[model samples]
Target: MHFQEESIDCVDFVLRKDEVLTVILGGGKGTRLLPLTEKRSKPAVSFGGKYRLIDIPISNSLNSGFEKIFVLTQFNSYSLNRHVHRTYASNAVHQKSFIEIIAAEQTVSSVRWFEGTADAVRKVLPYIREQRPKYVLILSGDQLYNMDLADFMQNHLIDPETEISLACNAVPEDQVYGLGIVKTGIGDSIKEFIEKPQDLEQVESCRQTSGQFLANMGIYIFNTKTLIEVLEDQSLTDFGKEILPKAIQEKKVKAYVYDGYWEDIGTIRAFYEANLMLTDDIPKFNLYLEKTPFYTRARSLPPTKINNAIVNKALISEGTILNHCEIHRSVVGVRQFIDHGTKIYDSIIMGLNRYGSLDRQSGKIPHGIGKNCEIRNAIVDKDCAIGEGVKLLNLKNVTEFEDEFVRIREGIIVVPRHTTIPDGYEI
Candidate 1:
């Protein structure tokens, strides 16, 4: 079936007639997105209320007309695994199109898990090479943005002689130190490359080469032969350290400058800020566009209902019922029930399951927050039951609060799943 192309900027590029395989690097222990990432892997972390981090990349791949994707994970892959299975179930129409979540356990050679970004791919080297695709697309599963990768790949394949193509973007000097910075040489060929500089001087020197420094987008396209040769070399393991630099030295590396809405959701603040971007009046990243549509496990639920209440800049997922609640710049996940007389601002309320009445209710679920409650600047995980009159206040004056059930991380309150907090408790 043909997908919509509204969101993506159409590029003029012709792709080769060959089967393509995509490998998504998703195993990194997202210590940065802490608390929220404390339970699942980075890619599994919920974003924009209903979608996970993996959905961004996976959706992009499918929308771009490439299939047979593999998600490589090491740390906390349970949620990631379940999501791919349930969301992207096997399809007979696109028999060749499939999204597989392959963990470190599925590595061909050793039983030990993936070590680094390059090591992760190295472990799965054999499996991917066996696919025999003309080109390989490498992507990171923890970023936020939308791009037409087909355009990038088309540029890469322009010269059939070229081996490695890297999608690059300009990042701030302070942030470019940890990533691979390239100095474009002759004909878009990279001349210099650095992997995570140790000092400010090195960063400055690297920045001087290009007026606008180019940082790797954590996305790559490699010729099947080039990948086989690089992976076969026992001396070379990591991409940033061994393969990429060597390819640059050999004058085989090419760079594609990408000026789009791409962000690395590396920390809790960054993650929250990125989510907040979706609520922008004119968001940097628009999911409503017909083209470049972001695909997700479609929840066959009814549309949302706003009852006489004013909601400004909020993302309400399908199957959610909001009644007389004022929500501003927040995200409400699937099947959630926002009762009347509740005000939520700058927060995220995940999936709320309505089971049988516990200490008894009139058939309504006590799983989520109750009426007359006010939540501000917080993230409530799935299946949490917040009683009436509860206030999760993140005011400037209040630095920290001691609550047994609630977890406060860096001043951000996190209410875990199935947690029951008494009414009138101020967190």
Candidate 2:
């Protein structure tokens, strides 16, 4: 227990930051994103060339001024643990503020692993209860969005009847089937949480005149007592699938309509598209917001070195060396080495630990992309070694693939960490 009772007491005294105890779920085995989640948790996976997925919610909480937080992690949580511990230490002014990691542990009372989102919280309710939280702000680790939670909390405070407040997004009609659609009745209270309502008529009924249906963002704010009551039923494992729908039936749940950019980068294809979206002329989810900046571990390395590189509409991270490569609409992460004559477009090159030329010469192990390669519509993970003249075009236009070092999911080839496509290999 890194959080002391004294520190919790300090927050309790303060009128701000104590009302809500933000609980961010560090996702389950991200099977959709296979090899990437092979060694690290989903939250620990790299995003936007610099920040990790967990950074999004943590930054949102800190930005919202919620100091007392806990991240529930399962499955290969080492990297996520290290990141939260180092990046989110106590603030200078508020020495009591902290971000703690609570990995699912087996105890005598319960030996079962986290069955789902609700179950994860149910197992750790004891610790959360100790903090004496008025409300519990449930967040997803892999969601890319920005919202001032103060607004959500304030809405709950003002509306005393609403026991649960759901952050709902106005999504396009096309995506209404993919999300948990909400139908709010009179008094702005959500009447039902429709799980993937298939019929067009059902979707039309949920629309809000903006030609977009009100979709549940999977962001939940629960009154501490109500959440505990709901979780007391051991059968309820997931929120969207079980708890929220049940709550809508029995309790007063309100829809906090949010009109903003939100992307769930859980699957490989979604992750690929979201990263490339960052390279757009004007990304829908802008990271350069001066007022509220996303927080991450500060790796203060050297500046990116571009030597005779033809770059356009790209996001190049720090400490990368692009030598005579033609890159367009791509994201290059930290400490990468792109050799001369490589043409990369609409791709994500998650950078390496160090230069790879020496290792390749010694026949030990290759690291970065070698000379004269052409890659397009792909995601190359960290420490990947692309040999000289290698072509990762997915020439066959594969929608799904699994090979020795490459994986194609939904037409996007993903090379996980430490993967080495040998010299002259063509895909």
Candidate 3:
């Protein structure tokens, strides 16, 4: 199925923006993405140099004209809450558009934290009911994609029989191992649904004649009544594992096939590869679109300064200073300071939150990458102070190792936030 640019008349046929409530599920303990999630929530983690992971879904919802949005966060949500408040607080005063953050809280009835995705939404049903929405759009916070959700809403409204609509992408069979696979019988109607099926025969049953399997994108649009009815069962916690499979059996669940670029940054390796993919000549996920632009906090930082730096295929964010350094296939975030004679390749340098003191004291390591250092295939988190002549090259190619200063996962070294490495140290 092809998704063309929606005409004005087509958009007018869909439900009003106020009648559609959008919910972005801020993820739980992001165990796969270890040190990155150590301090901040998964959605608040930095991505593409400047933007947070939560920005993707919120921007897509706003650009698509669905303004009444709520973000449900659980673990380590302080940074995520702050970012949402500072960036989107202005929208609440508008007539019909607002973005609100709903962190997990305990009430008289329930004291336990959110157990899973469905549970999170179930607990926030009171706020959702206040909007009087006819449909609810569910989104994942840590995904990378630009979708026209207005178009998606229009499609869902076209078929009144569709009580639940799932956005699906066609992926190879090999990629369906950890993903929810759906089998469509006729005319986009899902016949069977399985979450991470381990048996090969079960997976093969979902493969299409085009040699691809339909994998769930974790994007769901549900009729307000259907959502409430499914959540009535307290036993069902997760949507993929518990709720969806049962819904397919009882309700009219349909699949909206999407051929666009989408990546779930669930693991550290996936996050690393996704960040480096932006440095490609023509990345699948385009960040330069004008109509559907990615949104983030508006900062008043100055332009990046490059002093004789031989940079190639890199995304250098604002207010960074590079002095005679050699960088290739890397993403340097805001307010970074890289001294001379440093070489960075295939790495992500998450810049500092604020500029550190420049006064060079004896044995005092300053923030950012120091001089004469070598870093390759690693992720340097925010506010890290790497001493001069330190090396993070993972020379031994260790698959997994962890220490106080750094961690090596999948052969990529990660310097956690605010770590200060001594001078002349080597990994």
Candidate 4:
């Protein structure tokens, strides 16, 4: 089914913004990302050289007029909480439009943390129930895509019989076991949902006549009452693993098929590849759309300055100073300092916050990339200290590596936050 630009009138005819509550789940430890999530939560991890992963979903909600949003966070959430509070301001004019964080907390009855995505929402339902929202939209935090949620919600509002609406996409059949697979029956209804189905028949059930398999996008809009009933069952932890499959059998589930540029940054390699795509001549997912712009924490920084640098296909963010460097197909974040004779290719350097002192005598912190370094197919995280002449080529062609300062996954080197690579070091 085609998803045209939905009308505001149609959205208003169905439900008001206040009647629907948007919940963003961003508490994952992001183990696959490793050092990137070493100090921050998954959602707080920087993306596209400027914004955080959480910004994608939040921006989609606000741009689509779903303003009453709540982000559920845990596992090193200090950075995420700070970013949310600083960047997203509450709408005093409307009063109902607010972006708030609900971190996993300890209660008298239970001191345990949130077990899974569904469990995270289940524990927070009591507070959400007070809002009296008709529907609850649940979203994954670390996904990169642009979605007009109005279109997704309108499908459910127009079809009152659908108690649960999910955003699904057609994926390759080989990936059926890696994602939540949906089987659509009559009228686009989800007849069955197989979460990471291992059985051969169950995988075959997800295949469509068009030679594609239906993969769940982990985006769900649920009837408030039905959600409450489902969450009341304490055994159901993950939405994809437990709740969704059972919901298809008991409740009316509908699929809003989305055919767009959506990337789940599940691994370091995926994150690196997605970011590098922005440097291409024609990016699959353009971030410069004025109609639905992405939101992020704005920094009071100056424009990037390049002095005689041979740069090509790069996204250079503000407050970076590169001098006589050769960069190709890379993303340079804010406040980065790259000296002369350095070559960067297919890499992501998460810029620093402040300029570091080269001299140790003044007791100033040391950071940023030093001179004459060679970095390729790597992810240089924020505040990393890359010494001069250091080479990060993944020389051994290793898929995974574990070290004190650097880690490699799928041949992508990840320099953790605040790591100081000694001069002349090689990886």
> Model 3, range 279-334, lDDT digits (tens) per residue?
99999999988778888898999999999999999999999999999999999999
Compared with the true structure, model 2 gives a TM-score of 0.93
lDDT of 4 at 328: 95
Maximum-TM-score candidate: 3
TM-score-wise, the better of 1 and 2 is 2
lDDT of 2 by residue, 1-427 (tens): 1222232234433554656798999999998887789999999999999889999998888777777889999899999999998888766666557788999899999999899999999999999988998999999999999897777777777778889999988888888777899888886799877888877687677777767788888898999999999998999999988998898889989988887899877788888889988888789888998656898888868999999999999999999999999999999999888888999999999887666464565875467888999999998999887889999999999798888979888899889888878888888
lDDT agreement with native, every candidate? 0.76, 0.86, 0.90, 0.87
Winner on lDDT between 1 and 3 is 3
Top-down lDDT ranking: 3, 4, 2, 1
| TM-score for all models, in order of appearance | 0.89, 0.93, 0.96, 0.95
**Is candidate 2 or 3 superior in TM-score?**
3
Off by over 4 Å in 1: 1-17, 106-108, 208-211, 233-237, 353-365, 396-403
Q: Worst 10-residue stretch by lDDT in candidate 2?
A: 1-10
